[model samples]
Target: MEEMSVKTGVFGGTFNPIHIGHLVLANYLCEYGGLDEIWFLVSPQNPFKQNIELLDDNIRLEMVQAAISGYPRFQASDFEFNLPRPSYTVDTLNRLAEAYPEREFTLIIGADNWAAFDRWKSPEEIIRKHAVIVYPRPGYDIQTDVLPPRVKVVNTPLLEISSTFIRQAISEGKDIRYFLHPEVYRIIAEKKLYQK
Candidate 1:
């Protein structure tokens, strides 16, 4: 008999600092969903959000790397950085599928993102091509009825934290030590990021 292949989870995000919330969702998906490994696909630039004050791609990648360092199953990927600007999910998925033929790719996204799925580039194609694992976010409710066939909504704990809130706190000179990894927090403070 041929060896069975393991399913891989693709968790894409800006990962400004890659807080505990992100880690928790990834861990829950990997453990409960039987995912082989979770890759954190760091976006160089998020088209939906303005990037005038966003951190450098390498800096965000470094933070994600530091946050997920010890986890063997968690990987920080810079695939989007290498791809063209304004990276679209469909394009990324196509490239990834072509690059890794043996691995199965599942799209991991928050329920809030799912709510705005129609706004994404080639949203229909994305749903048709890969499995979507939607995790709960604070204010967004999961509407599985509206999703396509391949999407699976996971009832994971909703984390109240967000990178936007963290950035705001940092800009206001408030401590966000509890929201991020110690090393990441230290790096942000030392680098004086988000402070105008």
Candidate 2:
């Protein structure tokens, strides 16, 4: 008899500072998404976006750790750190499958990302090789009627919050304590992160 593989949700992002919105959605997925665990795969940077204002890779990773403090089902993965720069989704998924043979990794992304899925590197191959779970975004609408066999849309909270918002608020000296994990907020406060 063979051991069953863990159903892991790969939630990749720069996570400039992991916020409560991130935890809320991931927790919902862990309980309702039929996932055993959710890994917050901290990417060195997003290839699609400009890499102008991102914090240090290790700093972001530490903030992720602080955010997921008590959640056993949540994790912070720096797998992309060691890999070559300009990390592509297809490459990450393929490498993850090859490296972690014991875990069945499913790519967890937003409907916004799904809308631009075709533009990603080897989109078809990503869909064919790995399971994808698309969650709702505030303004993004996902068409369930055209979903592929391995792709499914899960109804999650439509969070309007983002790291950009948090950063802007902090730079303006606004109180954003409720938006982030307590310890993460502490780190920012103590270090004066994002302060202008």
Candidate 3:
């Protein structure tokens, strides 16, 4: 008898501060996307965005850990941290494939990103190598009919909340209690994160 293979989704993001919206989407994907697990790849650096006001990598990683602690199927990975700067999704996916041959990795992205898919590093290769699951984003229309066979468009409830919004709210000393997990919010408050 052979061991069962795992189907995992690679959800890469800055996760400057993991929030309720992120948790909700991940949980939904696990159910609808038919994934065995969802790995939150906390990028130490994102090439597309400037590093201005970015919190420390370890702190960001810790927040993700705190947010997803109780979920058995959700994992926080520091895989990109060990890699070189300007983490690209394709490179991360490639490394994961090599590291865990038994696991089939799917890329979880927002519909907004799908519109800019061609601009990514070797987008064609990424599509050819693994599955891409795109979730709904407010104001971004997803046309799965135009996407590749491996790409799927799922209609997850649009959670318009964003990390940027939460960060800005925190810096302004505004209440963001309802936007984030209790543990994550507590950690941010205790560490005084996002407050210059």
| TM-score versus the correct structure, for each prediction | 0.91, 0.95, 0.95
The CA lDDT of each predicted structure is: 0.87, 0.92, 0.90
Candidate 2: pairs in clash: none
Residues 21-126 of candidate 3: C-alpha lDDT, one tens digit per residue = 8999999999887899999999886556768878888999999999999999999999999887777788889999999999999999998899899999999999
- Candidate 1 residue-wise lDDT, 28-50, digit = tens: 88889779999999988666677
Full candidate order by lDDT, most accurate first? 2, 3, 1
Which ten contiguous residues of candidate 1 have the minimum total lDDT? 45-54
Superior candidate under TM-score, 2 versus 3: 2
Clashes of each: 0, 0, 0
Best by TM-score: 2
Candidate 1 off by > 4 Å: 46-50
- Candidate 1 matches the true fold with a TM-score of 0.91
